[model samples]
Target: MKKAVILLSGGLDSTTCMGIAQNEGYELYPISFDYKQRHRKELEAAKKIAEYYNVKEHRIISLDNVGGSALTDKNIDVPEYKGDGEIPVTYVPARNILFLSYALGYAEVIGAEAIFIGVSSVDYSGYPDCRPEFIEAFQKVVDVGTAAGVKGKSIKIIAPLINLSKAETIKLGTKYGVPYHLTTSCYNGKEKACGVCDSCVLRLKGFAEAGIEDPIEYEK
Candidate 1:
């Protein structure tokens, strides 16, 4: 059986990726982060998703250092952008890099051949880590940073949604039986999704494009 580690963020995309991994018959080990982000409910949502799928294991790691970035800091506001070139205040510095490194480390420990991430380019333009080049660069880094790679074994970074639009991702998730209702994508740590945040906006747009009514309620 091919084992894999999925970086699940409890968002629409990552939850979809979990379904994708299960569909591909990979024994899944889902990993979530408790990186002091403003929206901590997503971590709880991630646990629910894992239980729904019966993932082999679920791990949560903390990214300490509440310095800079709107996510970790309580003062900085998470800007609701007008969908332009700005990266926004919600960009956590080196977050993806930290998460990927931990995923790689866990993958090496368990001899997992691949690590799956849910990053996409079509819907998320603000995050640089979601780009294909970033994944490619990280793949190279993983190759050099591990004993498995040193022994000529490949550690592939599997990003099944890198090229797909958020709408297409939703379609795929639906096909794969992903429980969209179990996911959370809000940047605010609230009972319902604060629909104004970039994450919420993109998620709502995706559901709209997919022609499926989102199951979760949003605070408009």
Candidate 2:
């Protein structure tokens, strides 16, 4: 069986990516991060998702000291649905870069062929790290920095939802039988999703556009 590392955030997209990776016949190694975000809900959700998939290895790394963005710093507020064009304060500084770096290291250590991240340029918060250009650049970094890459084996960074809108991603995930109810997409990190926040808004919007009601509970 082929091995693949997935950066699973226990959120909508990353959970969907898990389904995608499984569909591709890769042995799943899902990794989540605890960056001292506002709430532990996401990490909790990640744990549940990993359990549901029955993955062999589910590693949760701590980045509590690496605080800067609104998600990691309580001083910064997680803003509500602002227009989607501007980069929000919630953008964790170099988050994806750090995440992919971790995933790359794990992949190399485990001899995995690919690392999957659920980053979509379309229908995403305007985080610069979520863009296609950044993913492309990170792929280069993986190619050059890893010992495997230098030794003629290159680890692939796969973003299956890069070009898809949130709605499209939801549709694809549904086709793959992804258990969306186990996922959380709230930046507020509440027990029930704070539906007004950017993350929740986009997720709700995607479900609406897909003509399917979201299975998760939301704060009224």
Candidate 3:
């Protein structure tokens, strides 16, 4: 089986990516980051999702020094319900860059053929890092910088849900039997999801549009 490194965040999209990876018959090496984000509960959810998949490695790297966005710094407040066009305060600077960098290194070490990240351009939080152009640029970085790439074995960076809308993503995930209930999307970092936050709101909207009720609990 071909090996793939998946950046699993224990959120709706990332978990859906995990399902997609499995469906594609890859030996999953799921990686989660502990970047001092407000929603640390997602880490626990990541663990559960990894367990569900029975992956051999579920590496959780600590990135406590990486702070700037509201998600990472407690001093910053997580803004509620910003429209999709405006890049919100929650956009962690260079987060996807840092994440893909780590995944690229790990893929080289493990001889993995692909790296999967679940970043959607449509129905997203206006994070610039989640854009296709950024992913394309980072793919070039992997090709030029990695030993595997120099050896003519370039690891593919796959964003399977990049162009899909949130509802479309949910539909695909449902077809793959993604366990959405095990994931968390609230930026509020509480035990229950604050449904009003952008993440939660998008997730709810997706599930609603997909004609499936979200299994996770949300605060009233």
Candidate 4:
């Protein structure tokens, strides 16, 4: 079987990507980051999701805790959902860039054919990195920067949920039997989701729109 490295954050979207990639017949190599963020719940969720898929190896990369983002820094509190189009405080500086770089290196080493990220342009917080333009630019970087790319065999960077709305993504994941119960989308990182942070709010809205009950508990 072919191999694919999935950027699994143990959230709703990334877990969906696991289902999608598994359905696509790739041997899963899920990669996660342990960047000393405020919450450890997502990391724990990632591990559970990986085990659910029975992946041979799950890499949790330890990254130095970078400040400037509410998600990573304890000083910056995670804000409640604001539907304004402006990028939120939760936007981590150069997060996806750094993550995909590490994933690229891992894919090259493991000879994986694709890297899966579950970033949606629709129904999301206004993070610049979650947009299609960023994915396209990163794909260009992968196309030109990697040795495998120069050799005419580039690892594909797949964002299966880029164009889909949150509801649509939830529907897709449901079809693939993704274990949504094991996922986490609470930016606050508490065991019980705050249900107010942008992450939790979006997830709740998605499930509501999808006409499915969110399996996780919330501290509303």
Best candidate, TM-score-wise?
4
Q: Look at candidate 2 and tell me the lDDT of residue 1.
A: 94
Better of 1 and 4 by lDDT: 4
Best model number under lDDT: 4
lDDT of 1 at 52: 95
User: Stretches of candidate 1 above 4 Å error?
Assistant: none
Per-residue C-alpha lDDT of model 1 across residues 89-148, encoded as one tens digit per residue: 888888889999999999989989899999998888478888999999999988887888
Give the alpha carbon lDDT tens digit for every residue of 16-65 in model 3.
99999999999999999998787669999999999999999999998865
lDDT tens digits, residue span 1-220, model 2:
9999999999999999999999999999999998778888889999999999999989999875477778888998888988749888888889989899998999989999999999998888899999899999998888788899898899999999999999999999999999998998998877788898889999999999999889999995
If scored against the real structure, what TM-score would every candidate get? 0.96, 0.97, 0.97, 0.99
Query: Which 10 consecutive positions of candidate 1 have the poorest summed lDDT?
Result: 63-72
Q: Looking at candidate 3, what is the lDDT of residue 45?
A: 95
TM-score of 2: 0.97
Model 2, CA-based lDDT: 0.91
Residue-level lDDT tens digits of model 4 in 13-105: 999999999999999999999887888899999999999999999999999977899988888888889899999999999999999999999
Q: Give the Cα error of residue 191 in candidate 2, in Å.
A: 1.8
How many collisions between residues are there in candidate 3? 0
Clashes of each: 0, 0, 0, 0
* Ten-residue stretch with the least lDDT total in model 4: 65-74
RMSD of 2: 1.0
